[model samples]
Target: MATADTSETVAHNPPCTRRGSKDLPPDLRIVLLGSSVSENSGVGNFILGRAAFDSEAPPDVVERVGGRLKDRHVTIINSPQLLQTNISDHQITQTVRECVYLSDPGPHVIVLLLKHDQCSTEYQECVEKVLLSFSERVLQHAIVITTQEPTGTNDILQKIIQKCANRHFSLQRSSSPDDLLQMFDNIVQMNDRHHLDCEGLQNFSMTQQPTEIFSEGVKLNLVVCGSDGTLKSAISEQILQQTDRRSDMELHGRQISLVELPALTRLSEEEMMCQTLRCVSRCHPGVHVFLLIIPDAPLTVEDKAEVEKIHRIFSLSINKHILILIMQNSEHQTAELNKQTQSVIESFGGRHLFFGTKTQVSTLMENIEQMLEENGEGFFSTETFWEAHMKKLEEMLKKFHSLQTDIQSQGNLPKGQ
Candidate 1:
């Protein structure tokens, strides 16, 4: 429960002795991993490189990125913006060797920060090459973090887990300090309690496949409510597809059922209840992840409180089956924006994840797919439901046709009359 921010709660002094060489700073033992390209490089310039890390990175950043373990704190140990040797040139092996030779013994979290859109056929070779040459020992101490959103219907993280056959891991994806700290804290706790680090955590036996990704017989129904302009339809669609992929339900041989809720909007309380509760009641025995899409515009404290009140009321009615997904919008680029967004969600007892819509659609779909593949249950075949939806569509179209016919008939007679 005592996290990096809560270090004061657990101890009076810093937890670890500085472990790097005497040349390294006295209170730090940090290293940087990933494609460490400099500011002048490709997409790495904006994201993948040194600017993301700082020796004087705020305290929260340090705790989230480098977890505290016993009396020896493990920080990223390499310099920022330093590229690993090219693997195909065979220099990568030597570079990793040098890092391993220099790195201290015992447990460390190797943050694998991969570039975005690197899953294409062109970059697949490089991705595989890095994974291949990166020693198991290094991987065992690793916490793979994908900086780029995976392009397919599912996230690269979910793909990796599925490829490994539902193997569990402590992997994470986030740029927020609070989420990062929670991730680090979870890893450290898992390590201490289970005698395992990140790698060990990944390799541990996940007796049953995670319910989020797949359920044997259960159905999950989620309702995501965010501000207007969030990807409500897209989120719902991805959840549908991902669950199909991960569940035991037959995708190729049988049909899976799907019931989608109508888009929620600002409306009267009576209308809101009729829409939300109706959807939930219909999707009974299923888990509902309510996405609260928030815009980046400044919100007064009263506004924040109002949103929290709404969330609380919903949670009480629904029993906390809601996952609050914070849709990442353009206005939320500032550090202040990040802090406020986090505070608002945590205050409401709901979990949150960030999504960048400006990125490729494939990546967005992939994130949703990952969630469903990680969370869905029951069958995906929806023959009966689709039939019903189509019937409704047909009825609406018939009414429209009749109205057009009436209007044309009236127009033809009006001039003469």
Candidate 2:
């Protein structure tokens, strides 16, 4: 429930003082988390008002550099880039330990430096893992400093900022050191001028343990289909160990049966009908959720047609069980989606999730659970339901054909006869 300071002015004075204070410490310690060695070092230099960190140094270990910023003794703990795929557990542990040891008592604020191009799901997971490794309440004392201005459409970045209690600063927008320091001051005051103590650090060891992926006696039937075959297969692979069309597994204490259907738009009408029936039969009892995977790009004419085709085949009733999964990567960084995509999302009542890592499978499950609770615990689709749905479609098609025939007959007879 952290409220944001909506004022545009940069000259607002903080409620607390950090310099020469009687009760507060004289040193202002900060930790920097970034995607690369150069990024972390550069931010550290910017804060210390000098070239304090070696950007060219080996990126394996963490380093602490101290200097004086006006009347305040400032310390910067430059951590090696932890937001990468290949970073080992040992490296993460060693870096966290070094950061804690160097900062001594603890850091006043943790600054997360993100570039516009680095806001992918992988990076999101990495950031979450690193922060949780430090302390659960670490974000309470954290400040997200993006290198560029953040837009409202970047859901992942917005979520991180929200977790930090709306405490955010843009380095590109405000380049002045004083402005940055003022943000730090705001964090200190908000946290009651207290740093993350040993008790908080003790919470660090918990994230090191394996994540339990069970929910106890819950079973989920998921049907994944979309316009992109590659994305559909990839997401299906993440859920099921084998690459078969249908696979079953136990996750988050729920037995999950997943069925991946081919892109309907790519198939002939007969093939599409056959595949649709197969999809319904495989998940025989009923489908709990339908995941439609799409590439994270501006909606194209083909994309819109693909979505329309899905509705036509599954019938409009499929809308409630559908969740649009947008696969995001570094290549497609534009957050401003086109009108067509917006309209499509609105059609589904904005049921969507930005997908990136296997870690998010649990999140997807939770969302599916919530959707089930809201829409009732019944299955979304079954064999009999699909058969009746096809019958309705056939009846609608016959009516349309009869109306066309009647219109043509009337036009022929009334031609000035």
Candidate 3:
């Protein structure tokens, strides 16, 4: 079982590490919430001490990863910008709870990043709205992390801290890696002063019995989904047959998990689409690559439009974790596909695969491997952009059905009559 054992959850005990109180620190669990206030917080990269965030970009959900800091096991979770995004309050809490469980037992600290480039009323309201998700005592385990690192404490920085009730810290884009360690140390000390610990977290009730999503949180599930149901099912089956094998060649370097979601079709119900997305996001906290399997045949005009609509339903951040999977039903269609699909596939850059047999699937796995490698030592991950999907769904449904309204307004197509 690849489950995170009790030892992993217990901060003081680590598997394969020397056990003792020889200047060792307790395990630290941190949840990072990003806002327009802190676009440049760089928490993920800072924790890993290397670039971890996809394209080194800020995340939209709790992108959790394990790290060692001052000899203590550290689990850091990064979330999307709450203030800037239009996801409902309930959904924001859902993301927060996702972080809490990923941290399991409970998080040691909640770092709310604030970027004060232009302090406006909305930014202030953002802080208040975020606090609403947590209990009033949350401030005790919380710290206001300003994006701008302090060279010497100045009036500008001090005012922001005072505004946040003096529960604030500053970090700069150019700050050295050690500075992050110091910031974390401060959070731990502050929590200690308030007498907060894992026991306090239980009383807070943030980590309830978890919901059954994705069958117990596998390390990484490469979600192969797209418009063509038949091709997708075949691709997923092939990938898994090799995934569970003991042959190192089949599952080398990392233990990979495969999740086969139903097709992301044009005819999908709004509820179904939302649920599918939520399941993928909630179940897997590690990095993931999304394989959007487009058929090898030339897409009809309507099919092309449907693809565009699917792309629009999520925020642009999703592009980072996605690879366009170009699947041919048979080798015979290669020439026609090359003429048409090449143009569409090229846009995803080098992140794509020409899917088929073991050799072809191997190439796809290699591409995915490269993605995970770029993410440093962590698992392959996709940014979570599902929170605002309600609005995106509304926009898509309108665009899909309102085409007739626009056609009627024009009164007819030219020269067809």
Top model number, TM-score: 2
* Model 2, global lDDT: 0.67
Encode model 1's per-residue lDDT on 83-172: one tens digit a residue. Answer: 333322223332333233334332333444444444344444454455444444333334444433335543654444333223222222
> For this target, which candidate reaches the highest lDDT against the unseen true structure?
2
Where does candidate 2 stray beyond 4 Å? Answer: 1-24, 149-152, 173-175, 199-417
Model 2 clash pairs? 213-252, 214-252, 214-253, 215-252, 215-253, 216-253
**TM-score, one value per model:** 0.29, 0.44, 0.41
Overall lDDT per candidate, in order of appearance: 0.39, 0.67, 0.53
lDDT by residue (1-417, candidate 2, tens digit) is 001121122222334454434444578888887767776776777777777767775454456678877767888877756666556554454366557766878888888877666677877888888888788789878878765544556878777777887777665543467767877877777777898764454233211111133234444667777776557666765554322222234322335556566566656576577667656765646777889887777776667777887887877678778898877775555555566667787787788877765335657767776787777766766654567677897999999999999989888895577
Candidate 2, position 77, lDDT: 78
Report the Cα lDDT for residue 397, model 2. Answer: 100
**Candidate 3 ranges with C-alpha deviation above 4 Å:** 1-25, 36-41, 56-59, 148-160, 163-167, 173-175, 193-417
On lDDT, who's better, 1 or 3? 3
**Candidate 1, superposed: residue stretches over 4 Å from native:** 1-214, 237-265, 296-309, 315-319, 329-339, 358-417
lDDT of 3 by residue, 67-123 (tens): 775566777766755555455443444455555556666666777765555345655
TM-score of 3: 0.41
